[model samples]
Target chain A: MLAKRIIPCLDIKDGRTVKGINFVDLKDAGDPVELAKAYAERGADELVFLDITATHEKRKTLLELVEKVAKVLTIPFTVGGGINSCEDVAQILKAGADKIAINSSAVRCPELITELANRFGSQCVVLAVDACETQEGWEVYLNGGRIPTGIKLFDWLKEAERRGAGEILFTSMNHDGTKNGFANEALAEISEMLNIPLIASGGAGNMHHFADVFTKGKADAALAASVFHYKEIEIPELKNYLKSEDIPVRL
Target chain B: MEKQNIVIIDYEAGNVQSVKYALERLGVNAEISNCEKTIRQADKVIFPGVGEAAWAMKKLKETGLDQLIPQLKQPVLGICLGMQLMCAHSEEGNTKGLGLFPVNTLKFPAEDKVPHMGWNQIRQLKGKLFEGIETESYAYFVHSYYVPLNEYATAETHYIKSFSASLQKDNFYACQFHPEKSGDIGQAILNNFIKL
Candidate 1:
């Protein structure tokens, strides 16, 4: 059986690593490449470098950053943010990114997912969904979770999958900065609804939350920023905890 | 002393740089090459790729490598999609491959995740590729379609189901994972291949 992954997400802004609470009040972590090497050495299964500023930049700079990270990091690295076209996908993949995550672009043009998947294979393309729980129930939001589409999370997830997204990185906007725990109910719904792997992001307080996401939420992996950036939960320690819990994690 | 000339075939696919870097890190004399004479003259060849199987195969066909690969005399190594393309046929694009190995690749069952992405354990080990690695040690994987286990299978992995993790047939050796990204175990596997 394939083992579940433990990933640390690093948000890059102007080539520097940054972490925020609920995607605001950004705090400087360190150089993106340096932090990536540290996480890989400390036993991170994979590292995700999100160029949060890519959407705002005049020209795409994530490719340059990916080239830098690829130089030092040996483990698989995924790059996301501001990927708009098939050429962007080709450029990043050529720069040694193991995978590329498409968020806003995917929502804006659903065909981009199929175009990428058809051209590069589905495994290279990932759909990043920022979802929030509302009175009408969980809904999908786009453009860094700033714009609410009012589309039901379940419907959007299914649509993304149908469009050839290999995996879905579901981030809960409600619990993003709270670090209380994952939106277990929402994750469970999606996990049960779709057969594809679900990467639970947003709120992860401690190692226990990681365990909960896997056991209770049925997430294939737990992607966190603040928890790992602040050193609140060491990757090796978390893996050990998950091992004791009978979850198959690569040592 | 004859230096082992290893050339990684390049056609703008993913994972080539890491493979080149890994070979360089191992102090192995390797380069990325697209020239026919260079590939034909190399002592050993490493074909590493991570992208659409159909498109990559098409690129190979366009370069006339699709024909050149099958007749090569030296030992050849293919990683990930490279391995899948060695099979007789691949369901990835209904692609007809190099036919180096008498096997067919198929997509993962729809009941499970389309892409069997993540690290999985290797079992039913065979050949020198797994020299020091113990049974069930993990290797990184990122593919949806897999070449089914057959007589050429060197190692097998179980994701949604048991599939070929590595395959070896005469001078051709292939793996479904990226050794350049698999850490120690992966390096060990690559080292064994280099020694081959």
Candidate 2:
């Protein structure tokens, strides 16, 4: 049986982790490498570093950080944010990232997905879709869920899969940060539609939210940020809870 | 034991850096090279691959590794696509493999998710590759195709069905999972391989 994964997503800015991470023992909370090592030690199945840095010059810092993180961490990690081309992905993978997630760049040119899948293999390509519920339907969003693309979520997801996206990381803007729950209805539909793995993101407040995402949403993995960063939910404890609920997790 | 000369074959198949880093953590430095002479000289060779079968086979053939690999006398371990390529054939890309394992790689039936991603257990363990590792230990796996149960399989994992998680035949060993990324249990397996 393939175990459901628990991932901790960290926002990176100028090679440093943004958004307060409340680990008391952490020597440097802003250090992405240290935070990543901590999360992995606590039973995080994987880690995602979303580089939020704006400047092109700062991109080099992210690559250095990725190399440092890859050297120390044993688990799989994905590097995303501002990855635009095959060259960018090559550098990241060369820097030792296990996978690379592309969002807006993929929307701008869908061929990038096929090219990446062909060159680097589909296993390392992750298509992250930011979506929001609207009067029309679950419309895909861009630029960190600020701009709407008018494309329906299901339609875009179908295209992404067809374009050779190995996995889908779907984050619902409406439910994100609400601490309410996941968009299970939409997630279940997407999971049913695609053959690849689906990673449910956003609206993860409690451990039950994790359970709901896996059981109700049928997500192969669940990713959360603040809840994990602030110690609102500990990974080992959460895995124990999931195990009790009959959800398969690596202990 | 004197320092073992380890070489990880690099043919632009996929991420070989992760494998190097994993070995580094074990205090063993492994040279990453595609050169036939370097691979032929190493005491142990690690063939790490990730990607399409036919395409990888093309790359291997271009480097003349397709001939050198099957003849190596030292212990040679293959990972993921490396493991699949050790088999006789693959349904992916209709690829003919190295024919070392006498098995065939086939795509997972569409009854479940295509790629068997995330952590899964390897059971019915046999051979020194899994020494000191418990049976049913979890290892990280990410692939759409799998090698069905066969005589060469030293370990088995059940996804859509029981498939070869690890295979061993004489000096050749292979694993369908990414032991480099499988945390403690995976590290232990790598340690066992290094000792072998």
Candidate 3:
């Protein structure tokens, strides 16, 4: 059986982790490499480093961080944020990232998805879609959910799958940071529509939320940040909870 | 014990760096080479790949590795696409494989997810490759096609159906999962392969 994955997403800025991480054993919470190592050791199925760096030399720092993380971390990790072109992806992969997630760049030019899938194979290309529920229905958002694209969520997801996206990382902006729950209704629909794996992001506050995302939302994986960073929900304990709930988790 | 010469066959099929780093963590420095002589001379060779099958086959043929791999007497372990290519054929791109494993790789039926990705358990362990690893232990997997259970299978995993998680035939061993990226169980698998 394929176990439902538990992922901890970290925000990176200028080569260091940006958000406040509350791991007491961590010597340097800002260090992405150390945080990643700790997460892997503590039973994180995978890690996602979303580089929020906005400097001209951001790429260099990100590449270096990826190299360092790849050297020590044994589990798979994905690097996202500001990845615009194939060249950018090549450098990240060369730096040893198992996968690369592209959002705005993919929306800017849908052809980038096909080109990336062609060059690097679909397994490594993750299409992260930021969506919000509006009166017009689920509409896609860009620039970190500040701008609306006028594209319906389902329509765009169908197009992305056709364009060779290996997996879909759908983050419901309406539910993001709310600690309420995942957009299970929308997620179940998307999971049914696509053949690739769907990773449910946003609105994971507790261990039960993870269970809901996997069972109700039908997500292949669940990704959360603050809940994991602040020790609000420990991964091993969460996995144990999931196991008790009859959810297949990698323990 | 004398230092062992290990080579990771690199044909630009996939991320060989992860494999190299995994070995480095185990204190085994492996050389990444596509050279026939380098691969042939190593005490152990790691064939790691992730990509389309026909294209990978073309690259292997271009580098003359298609001919050199089967002839090597030293232990050779293939990962993911490397394992798929070791089979008789693959439905992907209608690729004919190295014929080392007497089986064909077929795409997962449309009823299930095309790419059977994520952590899955492997059971029915048989060979030294899984030594000290418990049955039903999980390993990370990412692939569209799979080698059905066959005589050479040393381990099996179930997704949509039962498939070869690991296969062994004489000196050659292969795994459909990325043991290099499978965390502790993965590292242990690699360590076992190194010891072999």
Candidate 4:
């Protein structure tokens, strides 16, 4: 069976992991390599290192960080944030990243998806949609949930699939830090609507939330940050609960 | 210190980075090269792949590497899609393979998880890659299809039923799972490959 993936995202700033990762045995939890290794050992199916620091910094630093993490990790890792060109994808891939997630660049240049899929294959390219509820419906927000693209969530996902993105990492900006639960309704709707795998992101407060995302949301995977960073939820405990829930998870 | 001169065939497939990074981490010098001359002369060859089997094979053929690879004499390791392409034929895109192994590449039976993407255990280990890892230790996998267990089969794993987890034919060793992502067991496997 296709085991549901559990991913812990690490947001990188200035070449270091920010937002405090409180995994036991580490004094400072902000080191990207250390945090990544801990997550991998604890049964994270994959890891996403998103460069949140946007400046004149070259993608090299991120690649270097990826190399360091890949050294200790024995699982696929996806790198995102400010990936705008084929060269960026190539360099990241060369640095040991298994996949690349695109947001603003993909939305700005829809053809960029096709170009990447053509050059590097669709499975290597992931489309990330940051969304927030609106009067009309869920609106797509880019640039780390700051700018609204005025595109409907479902519509954008359909288009992303059409553009050849292998997977969709849909994040609910409204539920991002709420710790309430995932936006299940949105995720289920998109998962049913698209054939590509959907990775549910945002608002996971506990193990039950992860279970809810897979069972109710029908998400192929659930991604969280704060809950994992604060050590409020342990990945092994969550996986054990999910396993009892009949969700096939890697031990 | 002299580099090991590792060449990862750029058949335009995927997952080259993990292999390169894994090798470099093990202190075995590695570089990605697709040219026939460079690949043939390299100390070792690592063929890493991700993507459709047929399309990947097509790209290799277009680059004329489809013919050159079977002729190499050095140790060559294939990962994921690279392993699939070494089979006689693939059900994926209904394409022909390098015939390096006598097995057939096939899709998992209908309604049996389209992409078998996660950790699963292996049985009947009989290769350099499984040097120190205990039996049934899980390895990360991410493919919808697999190679049927046969004479060349070195290890087997079951998702729905038994299937080849690893295959070895002379100088060629292929793994359906991604050793680059399988944690310590994976690192041990890669280390074994490096020492080979």
Candidate 5:
């Protein structure tokens, strides 16, 4: 059986490591290459580098950053943020990113998903969806959760899967930054709906939260930024905890 | 003594850099090339692939590497689709493979979830690639199709069914999983391959 993954997401801004809450007010974490090596040594199953403020210059800078980090990593790492076109993805992958995640670009042009999957294989194309639960219902958001779209969460998820997305990086806006717990109810529903792997991001506060996300939420992988970036939870020991809980995590 | 040369066949499958970096971290700098001369001179050759088999085979044929690979005297290692391409055939794209091993690659039943994308345990190991690797240790994987257990299989992993995790025949070795992305255990596998 495949083991569940524990991933640490690094929010990269201005070519340095940064962490943010609800996608705002960035805090410097450390050097990306340094943090990446630390995570890999500590048994992080994977790592994600999301360039928060991805300007044209910052994109090139992040590209270089990905290269340096890639040189030291022996684990699979994903690069995201401001990946608008196939060309951008190509450059990132060439710089040693095992996978590429697209957000706003995928919303603006769904065909980019198919294009990436076709050109690079579906295994490396991840669809990152930022969704918030509202009184009306759960809906998709764009531009780092600033704007809302007419597309509902389930509808967009189904469409993304149909368009050859290999995995779904579902971030619940309602649960993000609160550290209460993952949106287990929504994650369970989404996992049940899709056969592909679901990476539950946004609300990961503690080790037990990781356990809940896997056993209750049925997520194949759990990604968190603050918990790991701030040293609130150590990855190696966390994997031990998950193993004790029979969560089947990579140690 | 002449230094050992490591070559990663670049058939446009991409992600070859990760493989190169894995070796360089172990003090073995690998040269990525598709040129016949560079590849033919390798002490150990790493055939890495990540895309469609038909497209990969087409790229190999274009560079005349398909013809060159089988004739090499050095130890050749294949990863993921590179491992599948070493088989006699693959159901993906209805393509015929290099036939280095007489096995055939088949897709996981649609009823059973596919792409098998995660780390899974490897057992029943009996090859140099797994010398230092702990039994029951997991290796990272990402593929829908797999080569079933065969005479060439050196290790096995279970998903929808028991499949060949690693295969060995003569000087040729291949792994269905990505050792380059599997961290420490994977690094050990690559180091073992270099020693071979």
Candidate 6:
């Protein structure tokens, strides 16, 4: 049996973590390396760095942060956002990210998935899908979940997998930032339909929500931003809670 | 403590940063390079990779690094695709490997659950890599192919079937799993490697 993965996602803006970390013991709220080290120390299975840098001048700083963060932790981490070409992927990977996630860029040019898969192995390629429920069905969105692509959610997932996506990271816009619960119904559908692992993201409120997403949602991994950033739920505590629920998670 | 020199071969196969970081955590200094001279001069060489066997092999040749490795007397560690590339040949792209281990790299049956992603405990631990480590310790793995269990098996793990989780032959060593991504247990394994 595979242990369910617990991943912490951070949005890096101007070489700093956007949602400031609230832990009293934490030395630097703006430091990406500090946050990642904290997560790894707390038993986070992986890390995600999303480039949301507001200023173009800070791009070099973002890469520097990636390198600095990559040095302290041993856990696998993925670098996402603004990776539009192979050159971009190469730079991020060189900067120390174990994997690369392409959300907006991948949707725009689906072949980018294939190109990356061909260059690197499929094991490190993550395809993130921002989906929202519509009258017809769940449709994918682009540009930080602001624009609707009108692409059928399930259809796009199938193509991405066909194009050699190792993992599909599905974030339900309806559930995102709402903290009500995960879009388990949608996740379960995608999990059953695909052979690869699925990471459910966006509506995590508590440890129970993580359990529900793993059990009810059939997600191989659960990712959250605000909950972890604000120190609402510590990763080790969550893993212990999952264990109490009989979930096979790495303790 | 004087740190040992470690070099992770960069065949453009994938990120060696995690491996480098893992070494650093053990108080060892490691460098990443595809350069023959840098690799040859290092105390220990790490061959880590993430790509198809055939394409990675092509890049190895293009860099003319293929001729430089395998001749060194120092211990060499290969991870995942690196381990596969060290074998006799891989079913992936019908590619010929370095023949360092004289074993075939095989893909799991397509019908079966593949990529064998995630944690599986290693039993029957042996050799320097498992030094001071308990048996049945888990490591992270993400690959569709595997090296069959043989006499060279240092550790064995089960996915579809029992396979060589780690191998040691002569001065060469390899692992099908990513020790760098594997946490404390992984760091222990790496520490053991450094001690060797």
Give the alpha carbon lDDT tens digit for every residue of A1-251 in model 3: 89999999988877767653221122224678888999999999999998866455777888989999999999999999998999999999999999999999999899999999999999999999999998989999987787899999999999999999999999998888888899999999999989999999988888889999988899999999888888999999999999999999999
lDDT of 6 by residue, A18-57 (tens): 7423211222346788888889888888888888642557
The DockQ values of the predictions, listed in order, are 0.67, 0.88, 0.91, 0.43, 0.82, 0.62
For model 1, residues B104-163, the per-residue Cα lDDT tens digits are 999888777657878888888888888888998889998878887788898999877788
> Native contacts retained per candidate?
0.69, 0.84, 0.91, 0.45, 0.84, 0.57
- Write out the backbone clash pairs for model 2: none
Off by over 4 Å in 2: A20-29
Per-residue accuracy of model 2 over B73-92 as CA lDDT, tens digit each = 99999999999999999999
lDDT string for model 1 (A110-170, tens) is 9999899787777777899998888899888987889998788888889988888888999
Tens digits of per-residue lDDT for model 4 on B1-196? Answer: 3557789888767677677776666777677877888998998888888988878988998989889989888888999999999889999899999999988899888454345666788779997778888888878887778898898888899877798999999999999998888877888898888778
Candidate 6: regions farther than 4 A off: A20-30, B111-113
- Give the CA lDDT, 0 to 100, for residue A152 in model 4: 85
**Worst ten in a row by lDDT for model 2 chain A:** A20-29
Candidate 5 docking classification = high
DockQ of 4: 0.43
**Alpha-carbon runs more than 4 Å astray in model 5:** none
If candidate 6 were superposed on the true structure by all CA atoms, what would the RMSD be? Answer: 3.3
Interface RMSD value for candidate 2, one decimal? Answer: 0.7
Across residues A79-182, which tens digit of lDDT does each residue of candidate 2 receive? 99998999999999999999999999999999999999998988999999999998888999988887888988999999999999999999998888788999
lDDT of 5 by residue, A140-221 (tens): 9999999999788998889889999999999999999999999999999999899788999988988989999998999999
> If you assessed candidate 6 against the hidden native complex, which CAPRI class would it receive?
medium
Scored by DockQ, the top model is: 3
Q: Which 10 successive residues of model 1 chain B have the least lDDT summed?
A: B20-29
DockQ of 6: 0.62
Give the range where candidate 4 chain B is weakest over 10 consecutive residues by summed lDDT. Answer: B110-119
C-alpha RMSD by candidate, in order: 1.9, 2.6, 2.7, 4.1, 1.2, 3.3
Q: Decide which is better by DockQ, 2 or 6.
A: 2
TM-score of the second chain for every model: 0.96, 0.98, 0.98, 0.96, 0.97, 0.97
> Interface RMSD (C-alpha) of each candidate?
1.7, 0.7, 0.6, 2.7, 1.0, 1.7
lDDT of model 1 at residue B47? Answer: 88
